[model samples]
Target: MSETPFDPTVLLSDDLLERFRERAAVHDRENTFPDDDLADLKAAGYLAILVPTELGGAGLGLAEASLLQQRLAGAAPATALAVNMHLVWAGVAKVLADRGIDSLRFVQEGAVTGEVFAFGISEAGNDLVLFGSDTDAAPRPDGTYAFTGTKIFTSLAPVWTQLGLHGLDTTSDDAPQMVYAFVPRSDAVVTRDDWDTLGMRGTQSRTTELHGATAPADRVVRRLAPGPNPDPIVFGIFSVFELLLASVYTGIARRALDLAVATAQRRTSKRTGTSYSQDPDIRWRIADMALAYDALPPQIASLCRAVDEVVPPDGRWFSYMSGVKHRAVTMAKAVVDDAVLVAGGSSYFASAELGRLYRDVLAGLFHPSDPESAHSTVATAWLGPLDT
Candidate 1:
């Protein structure tokens, strides 16, 4: 199949990014969602970037989608992070469709029609990461399932029309089977106002209380074993989620590196009467940032292409994807730290972009495929499963 061509530059132009950047701090200060940013992105048809062109979308693949995400993150990490939750669903649908499953076609069609999908998988103390759900998926006589659980870090909570979540159905014949489905916003769902955070404040990823929030029978997309099975739904969500997330932090790294370079050239030492760019230490730090940031984009592109083309890797795909996410976030945080050092005390102010980037980068550590999880995945892959 010929790849569909979609250029992100047209939609996320420098001008548009600047507008997002202008409002980023304001939204962060007020602890509000980036409503205007979402509106503009929606108007630009960006919300449907991953939907098939025949479905009234941009017809882009994961490679292109990840690139666009990187660009978006550079302008506003919080906005990009919030948007990531929506893109995850669309990307998952694309992944499923590519594998000959129309299970999530509605997700694709919904995005085309301007329906925002929020990721509602994260629950407190559920470290099993999709394998085990703390939420209860109580099956009804009509086959619909009512999910009762509180989802934490529900990004896009204020405006997401649909929420894609998972729960364990203990009452089912196959007890403890995981059920993946989409639940539309309703009275049964409650959006908590507690979203204040250290960074990515514009995301407003508030807590969501799903008290008997139900998904229609038709909306329940997948039922699978509650362990690390090789199910396509598992692959789709894990692959897309990790790649898109890595792209965001990689973009943050690029922005911080650029800012550091610019700062070094502009700042002159009073005693030496020379620009900081001339300092060996400053030059080395910039070089280190560049070296770290340079490796991520290509890695993201390659892995994303593998996902789009459905190329099976020689080894497990989960470990590779998780590693990419881990490295990207680690590199981004490092680059931001280096940039702050190069930019000096001025960058320490909360008003400084670098300061915000510093705080924002910290949030990357909390996302799925976190440091400990990534390490465990890799260790298991290389060393084989430990003795039970």
Candidate 2:
């Protein structure tokens, strides 16, 4: 109901965002998680924003959550990226519950009580992503499943209480069903302190190794045929993950645009003896940045609204979702590139905010629905699958 509609500004204040901005560089320089930012957001009831009011959350929908993420990302990309994992599970739970699959009600309840849920789907070189898993999901007589494998790029690794992941159950009657489950942090779950990266370091997206980590029967959320099915779980995860990711990158574009404008206004051209804002070349660069950025928010909002309205989930939705994510990332990258040039060498300094943004925006290239995959999805939709 948040897109019915809610004000993200009211939910996230300027003062709060400024605080995050102030701390972002420090955390980035130190390659550390933004612990203070998380505490502030948790205290502000952000982690539960997508859960229904009946579940004691803000009752917001994907559209509203997208807006909130943009605002959050503008201040601290790493913080926003890390927070996205928690919000994603909440959004997925909302998506499933609205579709009459209320299996993730516990996730909703947990968020209300301040339990952090992290995504643990990614595995090294396992590019099949949601449709497949390298992890083993061994079923027990009690109906629980023990997952044994390593999950890479697990955000919020240090603090997540529940990890939502998928594994392949090759021994089940189905003989290869993909299993989705949530497991609490335990002795079996080990997080490697190996999260040093070029950008978004505050996420601490470390390697997570599940050494026969067990999920109780009730927490085993789904069992579906692997390889791109239209199960509600798959659709839900795709819809929320793509849109939220698009929102984050779009927000980075906006921040870069703003910083460029500010720099242009303050900088002076030696030959013209006036602000760079007056220089045709400088103005053109910023304008180009704006032009590229202008198309993203509306697109993200429209798609998010479509998701909120429960648009038909099929092959077409994946193309649409992936397309938006790909565009957002590409556009953000282009805008940041122009931003660095427009702002001059001063922005090249490691301490510069724009410099952090430049590095952080690059991480977008690696997220799902990557450039190649997004293009392939679009091509298949328009021209049908390549000659078999």
Candidate 3:
């Protein structure tokens, strides 16, 4: 199959990124709808990056998507978080596209039409767990699937035109494999139960309910062998998520350092008539923040590149990929903490950029690739290779 056509310039464009940064500040505090941010990306044709080339999408690869997510996060973490959801959905579709399915058509149409998409997987009952009984889809004789369950922390639920839902295939009794279903907002009854949280409030990730919502068979995408066992599609997609999340957190740290340096240079203490930048202690803190931010990018970049190379060749590397993501999250959280320390008391103020960055950095860690669990997987693998 031919690859999708993507404008290589979009990821590295400075002008576009500057605009995102300006808008990020405006939306950072309101915690309201980020219509403008999404609109800008939609206009730039980014929303369709994952759609197959035949389906009128850019068909961009994971590397490009990771770069875009990092750049976008530098401007607005909330927007990046929301946008990440769409990218991951598109990726999931791409993985299953060749599995005797035509789901790419929907992604293509939405991308071309500048339509918004969301991901609904996390649920209160599941507590953000990836596999659970609460998430299941039962098939009917009419060749339709009924998705009856409640999902929470669903980002972009209020404005999503389409949603990629994950659940168990109740119809399959052999071993209850994981399943993917494409749900349209119009066909499914959606309830936005406000996901008011302390961090990344702009995400508006809310609780959603689907009561026996019938989804067409074509809309259903499934993994050939979905089990607790490692899956390339699942792990590969997760690698992208972890790399990008790490990038966002890294960006947040850079922003924190920038603010600290700027403040130190401009605002001098009234008593000393000396610039904070000149202070030995302050300069040391700034240096520490910079080092933390700088050290993470190379590690994450290498890991992402490794995943990109490994996924298309051999279908193995589950333990390695999980470790990369796990490490990225751990390092990112530590870097964000360092940034907060450099920002000092001002970081606590809602109006401060450091405050937003701090909040945004924390949110990504809670996503599907929980760092703690990933570490355990890595540790087990390190102890001995899989015996089977």
Candidate 4:
């Protein structure tokens, strides 16, 4: 776990990746969840990858998990994206445990038992993200909280056993506290089958409505004040979420670049009497894709290792992680665009993998720490907050 690299082949073998790749297209076409892919990943102990060895898990650090995600994404972007939610909670548990806090250890333990945890923090239009919540977390006399609100983009909606979420509690001793808690799938939790989208169809990321969904007191994790805070829970979730997101997009970039190279080499031009690989324009485009994609993995890895070692981020964690994510997503989109050009008209077809990547990469722009937010975060870091 101390070392930053893990052998992905042992877990995500070539055969496994191919299976995922094959199923990816079917799932995308049908707009269905990759149920078989999930079964395979669970059978391979991938669900427990971030959990500690003592807990019967992989015991790997964030850096290794990031690499594994990249490998998984290269073959099945939707599956990797769905699984990232599970890893986020597990990563947060490890972060807390390493810091001498054991409240979230149950999440690690649950992963070993094949339980799936989905992130449920996103709302329809709550731009505050982790800093605030619009969902109501009303406390009951029995010490349980009834969370009533809608959470959009709930990945793993069909399979998640537990939903980790946050909501604002207005009646607590500290009014307006953001309560971080988890609720098991129950009658109170309603998931609408409305996940159809332009890309990442295999994810089945539907909308979830919590109709007074109850989280027992023991399930409640953190109760921090609303707004940005340097608490471990906030920092841990932010670090893991941003790093893993970057890894997935970097993997997409890797795939696009690889496909572009293969297409250029195989495509021959009668006008030039040589493969497109010999064309200067195609070569420059491929190189441009590589030049943009190469720096991402290293950047994500270094930040992940820093997160693993618990380095003092000096209040710069937001800017650091968000900047990496924003850049990776934008660069991946550009790479996929170039890849389509290299592949010729064939790539424009809906069945083409490059076309799928082009669509999947667009989802990156909608993820947390978007372009505007990322730029604002960095600007505030370097130049301080705006004037009142």
Candidate 5:
């Protein structure tokens, strides 16, 4: 498949998707990253999808990126999930550049040049989300900052060259300011091989130990007050992360629905001497799955367009973005559950695609802006903040 022309569906051709699908189970069973899939995606210029055309990239917007993610996820959820980390950084750069902030131009340029950026902001027990950091950012005399902390679930851990992370600079005159920067992989950083998980195992989202890994002064992108601030970096990360995450699960739902439909058409009922597709109960379940699955893509597209068009960021964007992610995961799980039922006893096996999807969909609950966080965001948006 040619890299140019940039059709989301065409970019993921049948042969390529088949290769990813064929290797997914092995990667999951071995608890390893999909190295071949990443190479294929890189060859297709998938990493630079969000970078600008002037910067030697496809120059697509969030809507296009999200749709492509959904398509990729349908074939290999782990590959899509792992690649999401890189796309998150590139998407953030795109979002920032759209808002006239060129601080992340290096990110865009790096991606076009085959640089891999991993998200390293997630710290254990730090529920402040993007508002706070448990990692320490000690400033150096040379104006660089030495980041010292353990980041959990650092996707693309084994291969990422630069890590985008945040740390609390407590020693600064403006103490408690969150210092966001990109740390290059070197002797200062350590990646632990402890990514064994229930599903999405191909992600290899291992633990990262940063013992004074330094980002140069030029790479320190932001120093902002923590806690619900309206910084453009914060908005960019939130918008792109939530939308791409939602797109992955939405694609999973589409795959599950398609599988359910295929099973219904192929499996014959011993009782009626006809296919399950003719059965009223089976048809109703398929329709129910389709109904839930159909509402998500348009929602993702609309929100992505809002971001692309720079539709004045507000509190409602948070509610809508988070809500869509929450709904996509919930609906995907529902669709997969129904698919397993439709596929009958065969789907109960560990080797079944629906079985694998069932496990993969559960990881969504643990991602940022999760159900509890999303609910609170929506609640606060409509009901106003609880008495401080």
Candidate 6:
């Protein structure tokens, strides 16, 4: 048999790069949703990358999507975040196509109209505080589920027309079940609460409360056990999300590198006659920065391949998926930490680009499935013999 050509679609192209750079600063300073950036993505057909080709989407694999995310994040992390939620929601809609095509239409139309989307999983006091009692949904007798909870650090909520969320349904008798629901932002009230974070400021991640808001049963894609028994593909998808999120942080690091190098090249140190770029210490820092930045892409790519090969129907894929997410998030934390060090004093000042990258990269550490728990789970897997 003849070998198939290696013709995977390239998710990001040179043209997209041009547009991203052009609008990157405006969105960052304005703290507004990058509608122009999203319109560019939709116009280029990148917004629907996860919707499967059969459903009027590009059907790109997770690796390809991750690559695209890194490319976009290199220009703007906030814009990349908005795009990530769109693809994640589109993935959910794709998996639930049997219920209705409306979700797909919602994503598609949102893309066409330059309307952005965001995910709401963390709650106010529990905001990125380990996914505890932040939010929950209750089933009504009418088959509609009522969600009464506040989601904190919800990015793009102020500008999003649609939102994808995960919440617990305490009404269930068995262990708390995880429910994935999609709702229109227009129907829900967002509390314009402050997200005055140190980095990714443009994200405008705010608090939102859903008061007796009901979502149709068809929109609830998966209701799984609270523990470790999630669908493999879903778990793998989240791993991919972490990996790409790491990539975005890496891209931010790369941008910090560029900014540092540019500044160092132009300015000479006051104490030393030599330029900052020529200083041996600065050179070493730059090298370390480059090394850390270089290390993440291949690691992320390897995990993306492993995740892409996952078959959810097969039971064995669960641990592998969890392991991948664990490793990816760990790497992301370390790589972004290196980014902060590489930028040095400038990394702490709000006026410097490095400062922003440092702040945003730190936020990546708080993501679910980050180093602490990921390492714990991986350790548990390794110590399975002792538990027995």
Off by over 4 Å in 3: 1-19, 25-28, 52-55, 94-105, 125-128, 171-175, 223-226, 269-274, 310-316, 384-388
lDDT of 2 at 158: 88
- In model 2, which runs have C-alpha deviations exceeding 4 angstroms? 1-5
Residue 328 local lDDT, model 6: 41
Candidate 2 lDDT, 217-256, residue by residue in tens: 9999999988978888898998899999999999999999
Candidate lDDT values, in order:
0.94, 0.93, 0.67, 0.94, 0.92, 0.62
Q: Can you write out model 5's per-residue Cα lDDT over 1-388, one digit (the tens) per residue?
A: 8646447766788789989998988888788899999999999999999999999999899989998999889989999999999999999999899988999999999999999999998989999979999899999889899999999999998899999999999998988789999999999999999998999999999999999999999999999998898889988999899999999999999999999999999999999999999999999999999999999998999999999999997768789989999999999999999999999999887788888898898898899987889999999999999897
- Model 4: CA > 4 A from native: 1-5
TM-score of each: 0.98, 0.98, 0.84, 0.98, 0.97, 0.78
Residues 1-388, model 4: lDDT tens digits: 5844368899999999999999999999999999999999999999999999988999999999999999999999999999999999999999999899999999999999999999999998899999898899999998899999999999999999999999999997779899999999999999999988999999889999999999989999999988989999999998899999999999999999999999999989999899999999999999999999999998999999998898888867799999999999999999999999899899888899998998988999999988999999999999999999
The TM-score between candidate 4 and the true structure equals 0.98
Task: State the displacement of the C-alpha of residue 332, model 4, in Å, after optimal TM-score superposition.
Answer: 0.4
**Poorest stretch of ten by lDDT in candidate 3:** 307-316
Screening candidate 5 with a backbone cut-off below 3 angstroms (N, C-alpha, C), the clashing residue pairs are none
| Model 2, TM vs. native | 0.98
RMSD of candidate 1 to the true fold? 1.6
- Cα deviation at 319, candidate 5, in Å, is 0.9
Residue 228, candidate 3: C-alpha displacement in angstroms: 1.9
Clashes of each: 0, 0, 0, 0, 0, 0
State the lDDT of candidate 6 residue by residue for 1-388, as single tens digits: 9956323235566666767766665665655667777666777787677656765667766667777777777677877865676666554444445334353456555554455567777664553332335466787776667677878777776667666676788877764776766666545555666766656766677778887666777656556666555553255345545655655665665666666677667668789888878988778866776676676677667666655554333443334444554544444455455545645666666555555555566676666555665565566666652444
